[model samples]
Target: MRNTFDFTPLFRSGIGFDRMLNALEAASRVETVDNWPPYDIAKKGEDDYRITMAVAGFSQDELDITQEHNMLMVSGQKPAEDNAEYLHHGIAERAFRRRFELADHVKVVNASLVNGLLTIDLKREIPEEMKPRRIEIGSVKAKPKAEAKQIEADNQAA
Candidate 1:
């Protein structure tokens, strides 16, 4: 006997086929899928995040960070000097582009470059009404004096 798997049921489910089509479209639209610059994403706090990219040999003026729609784009370009002579060229100063997907409420906080690493911070502002709050319990109606006394005696015994 041979084991078999069925994919028809999965495709028939709601949005399953659309999800597959979207994945295919994304794969087809990738411009530089193989060119990946090293980066790190860290959680600064509950609603804050930081994205750090290793962008050595790139000046502050050569880097650009922009937010368009729901995408965060970071690109760097270093032009080669015409008069420079190199016996052996090992360093990579070529242009590169990096992108990140931003959530609906995510916003760029600040960006800075230190020691060859470019760090971009983001913060998601939660509305005051959306934040969790502690609710105060109001006092209950006055109980009968005899019933209250009986409850106190029961608590003392327990």
Candidate 2:
């Protein structure tokens, strides 16, 4: 059974979270997503992440990876053979495309294909200005204007 949700109420009350709400709505709306090639997402370190996808029988030339802003797309298409005869076709070589949504400041650093597994490394590089910093607090002493001027005059006279 498929499920659906209405985000109109969330849109009215929520502030500065449009992207997150939209992603949730889109995920809920997707009913038939192809699960041909399995994938896994894991965190390597505090700011490093890795995504591994099973892409058997796919070469580097046949695969395509693209990133636009916070969206990553991976697609593969096997070239058709000129003369091939198969009694029972079992392996799936059809074209497939997959998308991944990335958070802000997360970037794709590297990608590699080995042993039919596609590994993509991601690193989160937050800007210095956006990072949290500590502010030093100090006490201030107030002095009267007339006394300050008198002390300055006395110092000048001496």
Candidate 3:
């Protein structure tokens, strides 16, 4: 059984959330999901995030990581091997591609591969102008009555 969601109600009341609603709609639709090369996403800090993938037998050169706008793609391709007979070919040695949707200002800070695991670090850096700031409310002082009377007398003498 497949379930879908209607985002029309949200659209009527929400503004500037088109991208988020579209992403949710895409996720709700069922598709052939490839489970190979399992991955994990964790939040290390307030604005720090990490994505780790189990890529056993995949070398650094064979893997590619790219970021286009708000999308993160990680793909792996193993060079074709010559005729090698295996008694039981149980290991999954195939090319696979994975994608992750990133929020605005979220950037890939670093990537490292260790012990057949690929770890990618991300950081969200909001611009100074976009951050919330405090506004100062100052008191408005009234002019003295003596100074006002002096100005009025000067105008009368002129």
Candidate 4:
């Protein structure tokens, strides 16, 4: 059974949420998702993240990583073998394309393939203007009672 959700009301009432709604709609589509290459996402530091994928049969030449806007795509295609006689083929060599949605300001820093694991490092590079800054609340200075009385008396005498 497939679950379906309606975002028409949200679209009608909300503004500047099209991207979020589109992402949600895309996620709702089950056929577009593939689980061939298992992956793990881990947070290494405050703003650093790592995505590790198990690409057992894929080489560096066969894997392609691309980032467009806030979407990260990873795909692998094995070269066709002409003269391969296999009695029993168990390993999956099929082509696959996996996509990951990145948060705002998240960027792909580096990617490395080692020991059948493809690790992608990501860092959130929030602009200085966008980062939260401590705003110094200015203290309102008040005149002393004696000074205020003297000023008032002087104004009256003048």
Alpha-carbon local distance difference test for all models: 0.81, 0.92, 0.94, 0.92
Candidate 2 similarity to native, TM-score: 0.81
- Tens digit of lDDT per residue, candidate 3, span 1-158? 67789999999999999899999999898679899899999999999999999999999999999999999999999999769988988778799999998999999999999999999999999999999999999999987666444333444653
Kindly give the number of clashing pairs for every candidate: 0, 0, 0, 0
Between prediction 1 and prediction 3, which has the larger TM-score? 3
What TM-score does each of the candidates earn? 0.61, 0.81, 0.83, 0.76
- Rate residue 158 of model 1 by lDDT: 35
Deviation of model 1 at 11, angstroms: 13
| Candidate 3 residue 15 C-alpha distance from true site, Å | 1.3
lDDT tens digits, residue span 1-158, model 2? 87788888999999988999998988888768788789999999999999999999999999999999999999999998657788888887779999999999999999999999999999999999999999999878876566444333444653
Tell me how candidate 4 scores on lDDT.
0.92
| Cα displacement (Å) at residue 48, model 3 | 0.9
TM-score-superior candidate, 1 or 4? 4
Worst 10-residue lDDT window, candidate 1: 147-156
Return the top candidate by TM-score: 3
Give the per-residue Cα lDDT of candidate 1 at 131: 78
Q: lDDT: which candidate is best?
A: 3
Off by over 4 Å in 1: 1-32, 128-158
RMSD of 1: 13.1
